[model samples]
Target: MGLSPKSKRRLQRILPFGVIWFVIGLFVLFIQEAATGNKNINPNVVITLTPKVFVFAMISVTIIGLLVGAVEILWLGKLFNNKTFYKKIFYKLSFYTFFLVLTIIIVYPFAASIELGLSPLNELVLNKLSNFLISLDFLSTLGSIAVSLFVSLFYSEISYNVGDSVLMNFFTGKYHKPIQEKRIFLFCDMKSSTTIAEQLGHIEYFKLLKAYYSDFTNAIINHSGAVYQYVGDEIIISWKFEEGIKNNNWINCFLAMKQDLHKKANWYKNNFGLEPTFKSGFHVGEVTTGEIGTLKKEIIFTGDVLNTTARIQGLCNSHNVDILISEELIKELKPDNSLEVKSKGIAELKGKEQKMELFTVSRSS
Candidate 1:
């Protein structure tokens, strides 16, 4: 059977990094062994990553790493996406604790066995085998855990700092030179945000904001949209023009986020004593992409499209709808049998030269 769309997309994300790092790990081990002049490093005479042993070690580690990747993508990623700040800290600690212990107890030994078994059966190897210095030490376990944590934490930090759009832009200094591209921008703002803030007060209001944004994260990621910014209780979501048009993911994401938030209504009521809602406005147009600031660098998108999108979102109250879309975006949206769209006529949006036709979109069912 052919791969499902979701599976194919997931693999597309995983394959390149997986192969790249596997090669890097192999070379690092080879160089480390070659450069070590101190013979007393391990004292325990054993098989090392000599050409033949490097192949076996690399294969073993790569397979184990892939298994970890599977768990990370399929379970850990989804599990952590919508969690509160404290919950995320707790979950990551627990996961790392479990993985560190497992790596020491199981993964290391298995890898060692693979190296020894695959090594040439020469006298030196046979002698090393008899001596079999497979002694487990506290230092070894601690060092391995330290290395594992470093790699994991570094990767996590980088991923958190760079949003999907930044990654899609190839993450180079190239954007600093200025480039123009068409993108679908969605301005999603919390309904009655000021009132909600006043009701909850400052401290609790911050927590409420965190929880609300966390809940919508999965919908955005799954729908291939990237967060552009968060202003007050508003979040700016964006997709490449083509990315949004394909299967109408940009529109579907808002609907899916609403569904997700609805499912959490009871939790919100119990925790915050109120249910929060959001209104979204979407449009498609060219945005100038460039890096902004010197000390605190960031990718900035500037254009009329963003301003127009924000104004459209402000119209949600007048139209009595949760989502509003500009004619430009609506024209490109692929027809989805599950969704229905109605023309909301032309409206002179704030700070614009011309009246823009609008549409209110929602699930047909």
Candidate 2:
């Protein structure tokens, strides 16, 4: 899913904070090192600093931490359909790798320095270098490695929980349980999406489409809507009755989604001067819902309502409208003076004998 403006702003804000805090933490270590009067400090000391090593060590750690933090922020912004399972493993692997390298960079040098410090000044450096190649304690080193792994895992768990909490708050507006019957289905599709893909080539087109899908999916989720599927250019979104009623004021959600699209449009325009647009349709009806399929089960909606929604969306091309909805959906909506919805009158839809009323939503009501 795409990142909300708020979430994006939050990430921008936190990135600087992470950098600042990391620097501050290193400075604190530098102060401690200075007080201890350790002149020849080892860069391999796991989490310590001395006067001679503080500046370089601090810069290294801060840069690495900021890089990792930036990666986390980017990953958080990308909305994966199954984030929970994937993210858990991703965090563990990332933290384990980062801390393992950091520990090696810090501890090995410190151990060598300690051994050398006990010797004469001229022999100190030579002795430490020779001893580093030999007489290293395998058992103690193994224990240190185990401790580092455990610490890294524990730290990752704590950080993940904190990050998840912040992410949930930033992205989710409100939550309501799904109501049994009456609900609305909205489908939005990128026009000539395939044509763009063909022109851009598979790899380039996939990246662009992925970004578009991510943004749209996040918008639906943020608005407490369930994303059903992405069929090529089209995305199907479902809103249950109760949650729809609760979030009847969807102007904010729409604005957020539009802003996201605007960003993508600008990027594409800059690179290829191609502006992408979407056509959307909505319908409200009673539908039975439950999980379908045995091994690869998925939440499925049954009945003609979904099919009708697709038909309504298809009408957009002939009607020359970007967004259209059934009269049934209009009636269910709590009227807003800001929207100018034009009644298109009863129209005969293909494949269905009965006529259905439709409307077109424009900038001006």
Candidate 3:
């Protein structure tokens, strides 16, 4: 069976760390060669970079990287998910440094044996390994590993904060200039957020919102949705026009989100004393997308479709429905036999000169 979307995302995040470590390994190799020059400090400790030994060294560092990445994403990240940014970095750095030291102790003997054409259990190989570990070369490798870990942790934190897509865009300059494209957006707002805040108090309500959005992220990412913005109690998800309509993903994404929340209803009730509910509006149209700002750069979308979608979402409370979509967008969607869609009739929306037909969608049992 193919990996689930969530697992694919986790793998994507983990693999980059391995690549970073491999690159660092290459740099370390060069630094070591430069330091050793034409002579070895110990006559038995030769610094030869044979093709086979070089490949072995590269593979070793890569495996170390993959192991570290797995631990970071699966264990450390979750354990420190709610901690402060610096705290997360500090803990991860400390853990990675310790792991690096342990890796050197265990793997260096085997690697040295390969370079020297002797069994790792051989006395000369052991003596050479001991000399290398006590030499300045070992300290240099430790310094390099420490620097790499610190930089990598900082990169991961920034990537997580700005989001993976946005960071990629920044690095690639894909949206450096404004361009228009048709896109679909799902704007979801938590139901009774104001009342919930009043009931829970500021701190407790923020915690609820944090959990609520974190769960929503799983559903959105699984469905190939990009989180555009989080406006207080509302989250805006976006997709390329074709990507959204393919497999009716735009609609399925929302349904999946609803299902996810429902599955976690008991947890929310137990933790926050109430099960949170949400309403959403969907629309598709052209928008100018690009990187904006000098002091604080960001990618932003500007279009009337956003306003119309928000207005449609506002009608949900009045129409007493969980989801509302623009007639224009509904027409673009492929037929889904499992869906039951009803016309909510044409209505003049707020801040709009023309009226638009709206629809409410539900899953058929």
What is the Å distance of residue 32 in model 1 from its true position? 3.5
Backbone clash total for model 2 is 10
Model 1, span 67-161: residue lDDT tens: 55566556776678676655765676578667756554554444345555643444555454434435544354445444544454345435555
The local distance difference test score of model 2 is 0.60
User: All models: lDDT?
Assistant: 0.74, 0.60, 0.86
Which digits, one per residue and each the tens of the lDDT, describe model 2 over residues 140-233?
3344434433343334444444443333333342222222477778888898887898888888877777777777745655665656677877
By lDDT, rank the candidates, best first.
3, 1, 2
Give lDDT: candidate 2, residue 342. 85
RMSD for each of the candidates: 4.7, 11.4, 2.2
TM-score of each: 0.79, 0.55, 0.92
lDDT of 3 by residue, 1-365 (tens): 77765788788777878888899889888877788783445555544677787898899888877777788777888889889998898888887888899888788778778877888888977887787778876787789888768766776788788987798789889899998999999999999999999999999999999999988777787777899999999999999998788778899899989999999999999999999999999999999999999999999999998998999999998888999999999998788889999999997899899999999899998
Best by TM-score: 3
- Residue 322 displacement in candidate 2 (angstroms): 0.4
Off by over 4 Å in 2: 1-180, 249-255
- Can you tell me which runs of candidate 1 are displaced by over 4 Å? 1-24, 36-44, 48-50, 70-145, 164-176
- Where's the lowest-lDDT run of ten residues in candidate 3? 38-47
Query: Which lDDT value does model 2 have at 280?
Result: 82
Residue 162, candidate 2: C-alpha displacement in angstroms: 22
